[model samples]
Target: MDTVKPKDRDFIQTVDDHLFCVVGYLHPPDGYTAYLKYVPSPDGKWGKDGRRYSRTLPFYHVSQVENTYRYLKEKYPQYLFDCPVRNITISWVPKSHVKQYYHPREKLGEIMSRGANDFLERKLLDLSTVLEDKAGIKNRIGVTGSILTETHNPSFSDIDLTVHEDNASRKLIEALRELKEEADLVKPVTPEEKEGWVKNRAERFPLSVDDLRNIAEKRWNYGYFEGTYFSVHPTRTDEEITEDYGDNTYHRKKVVEGTTTVSDNRDSIYLPAVYGVEDSDEVSEVVSFEGLYGSLFEVGDRIRFKGVLEEIRGKDPHYRVLVGGAGSPNGYIKWV
Candidate 1:
């Protein structure tokens, strides 16, 4: 079998049968850094290829991922890794344990070639085709989530699309914004949908419904596609990834609260969204592993944030605020 290089948005099945979703581009030499997503269970709600599985973590909920660490520690300790650089225990799947590698781009090609077998797949095809033409990002987008895993239920599963390359991702978002204005094929979430979204997030984050609504309104990467709820996740290509694994070591400092102006939002759409900030001497950047905060701010916007401060050590040391991880239950970034 060919050796697969895992990147963000890819999925892997271990020899022990545990399923994990790759987190980012950087990794140690011996393993792929990922998070546990699914595990086999007799009474599991999700099924793929006749096997049942249960979800271990909730989508976009960092607190839940932290809680999951306890479960993993007790049941599958091998998946837990003590990283010397990050100074944290995270999920890392050993290279030798990988039974299969599921690349989002590859799965999407297969689907597009073989054709759709159900309603959800048909909608996915239509959505991808439209995005390819309108955004001029042909072959740059891929399907993910339950659809990629072949565990989607046609009745309720939402479409999850992944776009590779940072520039293409931004272009796609712009295209979606234009499409929403031009046609009904693509539209922002309805009031009802927004209400549901706000309510769901309010339960997990410290933000209120109004704050969540305001953030949701500013996003263009997720909404309704032909009446089906869908989300577009942007992944950075190898060329765009600047830091290598272990280049910078992060050490937790203390909880911080302050207001700052967003100076740059170029990399705000990607996972572990990074933001350049000004008007704050203590913090040079704000980094979030939580998906909710991605693309939530714009340049020149003033925002207040509460998160853990970290001291990054390398050739040039700096301070950054990290949101959405273990021990950061109250962490949040909101418009001022």
Candidate 2:
């Protein structure tokens, strides 16, 4: 069997049946830096192919990731890795331990080939087709989340689409924004829905409801399709990934708070959302790994941010403020 390299938003099933979702694009040669998502258990709520699995990580929060790290440290130490470049201990699945590799693009093609078997599958096809026709996005979209794993509940499982290629992803969001205005089927989240989302997110983030609302308003990736909740994740293609693994080293400095104007936000849609700042003596970029902060800002938007300052040592040395995932609990970027 050929070795498969998992990219961001992809999932990996270990030989021992543990499920992990790949993190960033760059990874160690020996293994992938992923986080545990599900584990097999008789009492699990999710079942597929006669096997039941329980979710270990309920939410994508820094605290939850830490809890997962502790759980793995106690029981599955083999999956833990002491990363040298990042200088942090994180969950890593060795290449030799992988039994199955799941790619979002491939799974999407398989589904599109077989045709829909249920209402959710039908909706998935309709949604993808609409995006392709209306947004000029073709063969660049994929399905993720529970649907990708074949454990989706047709009655309630939310649609999670991965839009590959940076340009297509950007175009998809732009089209969705316009579609909401012109089409009846595509609509922005209702106030009641926003309230529910705010309440759910308030437990994880430290921001106030008003702050959350402000951030949510700018999130073009999230909304509704045919009255069904859905979110579009922008993923970079292989060619779009400029930096390779071990290209640079990062050292976490001290936490810093400041206000800066956003100079560019083209790459802000991806995970580890990168934002170019204008006229900053200490830092030039603000990178965030939290999903809530993705696509949360625009060019020329002045924002206040609190995060860990990181020194990047490579051919071009510079400083950047890192938000989310071990940065700091209070780390955030908001309108200034």
Candidate 3:
């Protein structure tokens, strides 16, 4: 079976026939195996009446396919792992995974075909138009999240936009800043929403209301528009998306599991997202590749995390416990 590359959404099946969404880039360092985040399994074993069965939990945290299978066998030895997606044969675990590639142009066409009154449709069109006209890379923006999955409720869903090229991403960030100030098209988030956002984020990490707002205010790529939240995630163009890190090589080291205290999140808006942590291990920073958790963790709260550790050796030897390295569930955060 072919590997699941970046920008692809996959429906993965385990040996027990349980299904999950591969939430991010699926090409693990070793192409033969996959590292995946556990989504609410789309299993119909439980009745799916209305929205009652829409979500399920006790979700297995991020794990490799074989590891998860082994863990389960120890608990429920009678359960068998057999189901595999197309083109994959079941080994101890199935090698097959089902994936759907994300096409920005095709998704844009679908959104355009919707009538004018559709809230999400109008928001997407306006944002794309602004980025295209100002940055000249309109065609590179792709929709993700609820809108991309077609499960969005126009009245409630926020816009999740992707800018494919690095240069384009920089331009989009600048453009978004200007839009928030001058364009009536993008509106400021209501005080109520801001309060709700602060409270919700504080519960996960220990940050004050002001600290949360300060980080958010600096990020030009996300804001409120038309009474809804929107975020622009910028990723390198296909040609630039490589895994090489030169002399600073990395690997999937032992999972660092502990409760640590957060000290700072002032630069929470950027990549290799950092937070000063202490009284845990030698690890000084909680670096996250996923943007969602960048601002999610704040100062003072006791956070429990398990992630791939990358250690740099030299005169200045230090460690970084990377969270959300491959996005949610595969990487995680919780206030203890």
Model 3 lDDT tens row, 294-330: 5566689788776767675533357878875532245
For candidate 1, write residues 201-290 as lDDT tens digits: 888788988899897788778777768889899987667877877888989989999999999988888878889999898799998888
Local distance difference test scores for all models? 0.84, 0.83, 0.54
Q: Provide the lDDT at 87 for model 1.
A: 87
User: Which residue segments of model 3 deviate by more than 4 Å?
Assistant: 1-4, 8-26, 29-95, 103-105, 109-119, 244-286, 290-309, 312-336
List the candidate numbers ranked by lDDT, top first: 1, 2, 3
Q: Which candidate is the best by lDDT?
A: 1
Tens-place lDDT digits, model 2, residues 180-230: 777576778877878888889887777888989887677787777877888
Cα-based TM-score, every candidate: 0.94, 0.94, 0.58
The number of clashing residue pairs in model 3 is: 2
Whose TM-score is higher: candidate 1's or candidate 3's? 1
- Candidate 2 lDDT: 0.83
Error of 2 at 22 (Å): 1.1
| Model 1 lDDT, residue 255, Cα | 93
